[model samples]
Target: MIDKVFPTPDEALHDVFDGATIMFGGFVTAGTPTNLILALQRRGTKGITGIANNIGLGDKLDVLCEQRQLAKMIATFAIRASGARQSLFEEQYRRGEVELELVPQGTFVERIRAAGAGIGGFLTRTGLGTLVQEGKQIVNVDGVDYLLEKPLRADFALIKAFKADRLGNLVYRGAGRNFNPAMATAADVVIAEVEHLVETGELDPETIGTPGVYVDRVVQCEPVPVRWYG
Candidate 1:
């Protein structure tokens, strides 16, 4: 039996180095991997390229961006809306201090999924003739033009889950399931921060969303109260 469990967040993420690309799992802050993010932030590894739905809702709590830790962010939303708190990422990006790749929401997720699935790239009409198609290839099949969107693999994936068995199988609760599963398969090292760390057989096989084989490390974290809206 493999012991994927780690004693602490630092030990689990000790190997993460500078200039590594990381995929963050969450829908804004709802199911964010706050614990793992904290560990990485403390490590102070620089030149990171973060892939996420958003940087943060312009809050001081976003240490990764606030501390100038990321060299770039490949996300759907890095800038906040009017009257929203402004995050440090926006400040840096606007001053030409950092890089930003703003992908269309659907295209961004699909790219990550494609990487995990081992596909080179996929063609989509989502960004045809738009800024998203600028440097990408354009393929025409029949009469429709599709933009070639590349896969988005990462060196590490930090995900928050509800429960994880010793074998690394994970069960995410509610909204946490959003990007965790996909990012799990897309990264070389997947360190999961879960609320509950159970023994192998303690978990019901049917409830697992991310199989253990895809996860390399698991750390226990306290589950926070969360509510979802449709």
Candidate 2:
């Protein structure tokens, strides 16, 4: 029953320094740690490498990109469809202020998982014949083509949860759970922000999606500003 709650988002992320590689959870902004992202924005930490499903839409995770705090982004989707907030990410890329590495969604998740599991490398058929194999090593297994993919690890993992126990056990609701769980195990440290915080025994053991062992810190966040996406 370790109480991991911090007084504020800034306090929870106190040790996060500049030039950190961060794995951010949420699929297209549904389960993003809005408060934590805001805290990082306010803290003004620079040279961050963010790994996520999408860079977020509109002002969702735009704080970092807008502030130029991000040095690079590793994600499945790098740009928005329409042109509203496009300037934020686009300007950075145009000026060579930020670097972006796009990967297939399935490859993205598996790479994180592989790193977390301590596997050296994995062979996948997902990107065997496309541009993904261009700069990568390709291997043949039983006459089938597969790419030898490297694992991805990070310095910190920022995740959002629907509910979290005092011990840092977490449960994510709906699609919010996407990259959070895999990011949880793949980083050196994990900071979780949740809407609800409960006592240690409040959550059922079988229901906990992320155990306390992988999470190092927790903070209770206010309702995030939900725009058209929510």
Candidate 3:
């Protein structure tokens, strides 16, 4: 019997060490793996490099920022547009306590996807004439300039799912599916925090967003309230 289910988030993430690069699956607050983030917080591991679409912004990942556990962040959204609500990550970044790699949204996802697909890097014109092209290799093809973006991989990926089978086939709901599937494939270890855990055959094959092979562990957790939505 191949069972990937773990009793708790802590146990599922027991092997996560200090100075690990972790990919957090979410788009703002949606699909954020709150339980796993809490578990990692409890463990108090430091020097983490987190890759996410956004930092804090009502997501439980702010707790890590508050603890100064993150050494750096590679994300698309790390600060507020209006600068009204200052996130812990933004504060730390402004104070020079942590490093930030601000990547364009499309380029960010494509980098992670490239890692999963075994691609070395890609050339795109998305940021050809912007700061994003600085310090990056420039390639010219047909008299057009493109920036070379490297693949982004992580030591572990913490993802949230609507449901998962004991074997770890994941099914996501609505916006919750944002980065989970792609992150799952781009990490060395992938743990899923799901609302429901079902039997192996219960999940419909067509509905599975991340297959069991990509998932190393699965833990059931109660749905975290979406406070940002209120």
TM-scores for all candidates: the values are: 0.93, 0.94, 0.96
Order of the predicted models by lDDT, top scorer first: 3, 2, 1
Higher-lDDT candidate among 1 and 2?
A: 2
Model 1 regions more than 4 Å off: 58-61, 224-230
User: Can you write out model 1's per-residue Cα lDDT over 120-223, one digit (the tens) per residue?
Assistant: 98989997867888988899999888999999999999888999999999998876688889999999999998989888999999999999999999999875
For candidate 1, the TM-score is 0.93
Candidates' RMSD to native: 2.5, 1.8, 1.3
> Candidate 3: which stretches are off by over 4 Å?
none
For residues 28-78, write the lDDT of model 2, one tens digit per residue.
667888889889899999999989887756335667977789999998887
lDDT, candidate 1, at 195: 88
Identify the runs in model 2 with alpha carbons over 4 angstroms from their true place.
80-87, 228-230
Candidate 1: C-alpha lDDT: 0.84
Cα lDDT tens digits for candidate 3, 60-174: 8889976899999999988776757788888888899999999999999999999998999999999888888889999999998889999999999999999999899999999
Q: What is the lDDT of residue 134 in candidate 1?
A: 91
**Cα-based lDDT for every prediction:** 0.84, 0.86, 0.91
